[model samples]
Target: MDFVLVHGTTQSPAGWDRVAKLLRAAGHRAIAVDLLTPADLPVEGYAQHARDQYDGERPVVVAHSGTGVLLPAIAEALDARAMTWVAAYIPDFSGGRSLRDEVVELFAPEWIGVDPTADPAKASEFLFHDCDPETEHLALDSLRLFSPAVLAAHRAGPAPEIPSTVIVPTRDRTLKPEWMRQAARDRLGVTALEIDAGHCPHMSRPAEIAGILTGHA
Candidate 1:
């Protein structure tokens, strides 16, 4: 099966390196997209840019963190067979709220204005605490800074009708575990799959993540 790994904010394609490698070793194609959109671009532009990365494989699209807001559109465009959201934001398609609104309401005060790319120390402690030194270093080094303006610019559309699963990182320090569980149940109407890791599970627990992906389908 083909898998498209969509990264979150302040992240590069390298963030999915470990998981992608594991998938490939198991004879599956994995494309880790680099969706570092420019600050001037809106969420629509970000969606289009991400769509253009693949050739309509209808793969199982996996979204991480901030990329959740872009998932519905990207999934519809790709005609995805299945979707997996990893400690991600679930957009409100009712035209009720924006990504910024969700962040302000759901995120912890300390995580509000924090940029992982700008502060590697903070990122290491919060986002990659479970990772080894080398993995953490690689993640920190590959961070890409971008404006949060795009979050406010996002206008979510109806989510596609497909098989979707939400994976919550039980030990995550950045995004609250309670919110992850609540959002998964209330927004997606499904029980989340829990994993023992920090924010970047693909980096810290690649084998476990890969096992879930393969077994899920």
Candidate 2:
């Protein structure tokens, strides 16, 4: 499968550098896409960035963190074959169309601590749990903050139904892990898997995440 992985807010595609290497080593097609949103723009704008890159192919859409909200639309717009989300954000919209109140609720407290002027390294601690101090600092160097408005706007729902895989990181600091798992089942009819990693499983346990994808592949 042609797997195109996406990054979340306050992030670029750099986090997938290591995972892409591992995927290639295992003879799998892995492409980490660049969701080029402004440094200070709301992440929902980044969702549109994701939509613009769609090529309407059967590539596996892999979304990490904030981009999950966008990938559903990407999959529908591009007519993707499947999706495998890694600790991704999935919104359960209440009406015909609208961002859930959960948007601001999900990251509010965490957003409060991050100074709008602070860089990625400082933000990583809040999004991920128990990562190497240096690794966290290094990975977060490319971070950016998203506004609540952008995230809400990016809450585009998926087509009637689609096949998807959602991997919930049990120790995740970003979202309630258990709730995310149940969400995969309720929202997207996802074939759910649980990994014992934090928000960035591709970084913390590349092989294991790859293993699950390959198993599905």
Candidate 3:
């Protein structure tokens, strides 16, 4: 199976390195799309960019953090076999609401309207508290800044119902875990798989993530 991993807004594709390596070791093709470059694109444009990055057969598209806004469109464009959201936003864009609007209230007070990429310490504290020193350092150093335009992007139409799973990070310091569960149930209409980790679980718990991916596939 092919897995296309999309990183969060403040992250680089390298964030998916550990997970990708494990996926490959398990005989699966895993590709992490670079959604940061040309960061001015809208939600739909980012979906197109994600599609162009991988040419594999119908893939299992995975979204991490803010990148979940791109999942539905990317899934449609790529004819994805399944979708996975990792402590990620699940934008409904219903009533023409922007991704930020849908998820803003769920963010921690310190995280709202602040650029996580600007402060490595805060990024590590909020997103990588569960990570080892090596992985935490890599994630902090590779943090990327995104334009406000992308945060304001919204879908114009409803998305098709696809097989999907949400992994909620119970110890996440940025987005509230309680809301994550509620959102998954209310918006995605599914119960989330709770994992004991911070926001960036791929870096902190790659083995477990890889197991879930392979097991579900």
Top candidate (lDDT): 3
Residue-level lDDT tens digits of model 1 in 1-217: 9999998876778888989999999999999877774456666676677788987577999988887887877777777899999888888766557877777666766877787777888888779999988888888876876445766557676656878888889988878889889877777778999999988898889899999999896
* C-alpha lDDT score of every prediction, in listed order: 0.81, 0.67, 0.83
**Per TM-score, what order, best first?**
3, 1, 2
Per-residue CA lDDT of model 3 for 93-164, tens digit only, reads 455666656555778877776777887778877888898888888878768875546655665466567888
Residue pairs clashing in model 2 are 10-143, 10-144, 42-147, 44-150, 120-140, 121-140
- Residue-level lDDT of model 2, residues 1-217, one tens digit each, is 6777787665667777777787888887777777664463444455456657655457777888766767676565545678777888776643334344564445434644454227544456555455577666656664554434555564454443667888988878766687687778777777579888877787777788888877885
Q: What would the TM-score be for candidate 1 when compared with the true structure?
A: 0.92
Candidate 2 lDDT at 49 equals 61
Overall local distance difference test of candidate 1: 0.81
Per-candidate alpha-carbon RMSD to the true structure: 1.7, 3.7, 1.7
Runs of candidate 1 with Cα error greater than 4 angstroms are 37-39
Stretches off by above 4 angstroms in model 3 are 93-96
TM-score (all chains, Cα) for each model: 0.92, 0.79, 0.93
Model 1: colliding residue pairs: none
lDDT (Cα, 0-100) at 42 in candidate 1? 64
Off by over 4 Å in 2: 37-56, 93-100, 104-124, 146-148, 158-160
